[model samples]
Target: MLFPLFFMLMFPVECLTDLIEPITGGVCGIMTPEQYSEDLYMEDEILSSVSLSIKESGLNDVSIAPGYGRLLTMLATVSKAGSILEIGALGGYSGVCLARGMKEGGRLISLELKEDNAALARRNLELAGFGRGTEYMVGPALDSLKQLESRGERFDFFLIDADKENYPVYLEYAIRLAKPGAIIAGDNTLLRGRTLNPDKNGPSVLAMRKFNDMIATDERLISTMLPAYDGLALAVVK
Candidate 1:
């Protein structure tokens, strides 16, 4: 009985870390594994039930955790954002969050690479009643962003949460697309705790470090990194 209870107690912790590991690399300095798991589960439940048909598409796991979702909503509302851009549309979970906080007559353009993922995202958004407000572009983000730039499209808020290696390149494009005073946020900047140690030396970790250093030194934007959900970097375009 004692052994069984002990196993039960430890199981959730392992599960939570496993869930977050893909994004955070199991590095959460501010929150305990149990706390993170509990919080993430609650968040997942809320988003999962939002009438999004794609809710059952296994894309919810690709969405931002609850804490980051809330933050995105708040920021969109606070900025009175009418135009938004997202580099990644993984399952449309974050798209729903951003759309919910959008001002009246707001529009969001989300880019995704995989056709199946785009379709799933569309389904999710439609289910959430956010489909009308979002445009799902199925292709590489770089190509899509270039098209937007060519069309002279600009956004009030931008969120970057796509490929790890493309962060800096995304930053450049985001900077070009943003209006002055617009907020640009990048997810997973911490790369788990590997960034702090510096010795682990994975490609993602190295990319994050380079991006962090670049952001810190950049004069065009005011930037800060938050330790929320594997780490988020927030920058306000000047």
Candidate 2:
């Protein structure tokens, strides 16, 4: 009886997509509470294994973390990014998400300094059926990015998640290699929410604050920082 009632309620399931505006109140926010709850209903076993691997490797604390993974995927999908560049590929968790969102024939190039982490990321990408769409380059992001530039590679989307102190330099490189209308996203801009306090003296926090200030005043791009995991700064090149 309950199943019949539920089926009747959802008989016109196609209508839900059209109702998104009313359901979400036309606000540009992350997944709603309902959506989040629904996400918890479906679990990807490979993703679970990837998370466990990061934890077992003792790098969970310093890695991209969980919620940010979903955010990256959303960005790639919304932007319809066909060529993506990720400055950091900690354990491949985020890479999996980003790769999954790539348009058909799209590709993602991820940079990582640690061989072990890169290997793990490669495995994770393969597990997610994104092995062909994703490439892991082992080296400092700055060096790798320079090589990409030298090769005349331009990306439709850029994700910066490398060493915080080098964000300004990374931002410059990202801008240079990004095509007009490309989207650039930076992770950890909030530095654990310390960006608002101004009392933190750590180099990462300070660098993030300075980078934020620099981009905020730049005329070439329109940017905004979203209070997501840690924080995410997104800019669209004009």
Candidate 3:
């Protein structure tokens, strides 16, 4: 049932290819990303408020796009994830999205590097009604991942959107801590399309390419990369 629902929700994304098939003068389909967000992607107004606050606070606008937020919610919901681990928490925008998909009593643990960022995330999550079931661990995410590993904590779903260079490590930790059949998702896997450039050999690009390869060839999981919105990599633990 969940798979069916997931596919139904993905119909729009699937049709996207054909939508721009007749690429007249290289223009994308009839809708821009903003238009798609406004028309097709349903976002919570609290998210709007969060975005505004982030801008007001002069914080880096690193939050996921609205359509991507909707994607996170749908993935979490369809996976029936009881426990979620988010590797990055930017003002709790993604946290709220994941929390909205949780079954009653589902737990969400977020690992953020900066104390200020985590603090803002906590406050925003509280405002979004997810404070009770969400946990925030500030400092390096790799350290937190190690701690979670030591504690033998397992998650039903994991979302990685942190530093690009550590993506492989994060993916490994996520797999190790994942429950069987757990879903592992990575945002920005395309690394702003640097992974596709033959000339760009930055550390981030190399790491992202390796991460994508692992997701594609790893025998322990079945995965696919959605080549939109900075690229979202999704895999299921075998």
State the lDDT of candidate 2 residue by residue for 5-101, as single tens digits: 6865764666545455465422344576535744685547877888788888888546564566666778789889999998888888778878877
Off by over 4 Å in 1: 1-46, 50-60
Candidate 1 vs 3: which has more lDDT:
3
Best by TM-score: 3
Could you give me the TM-score of model 2 versus the true structure?
0.79
Candidate 3: segments with Cα more than 4 A from true spot: 1-30
lDDT of each: 0.81, 0.82, 0.86
Looking at candidate 1, what is the lDDT of residue 40?
Answer: 68
Per-residue lDDT of 35 in model 2: 57
lDDT of 2 at 92: 84
Candidate 3 residue lDDT tens string, 1-238: 6996786576577565654477432233466555665676565589988887777878988887677788788988988989999999978888988998987899999999989888999998999898999999999999999999999999999989889899998998998999999999898877777888899999999999989999889999999988776888999999
TM-score of each: 0.79, 0.79, 0.85
Which 10 successive residues of model 3 have the least lDDT summed? Answer: 23-32
lDDT of 2 at 148: 97
- Say what the RMSD of model 3 is: 10.5
**How accurate locally is residue 211 in candidate 2, as Cα lDDT from 0 to 100?**
89
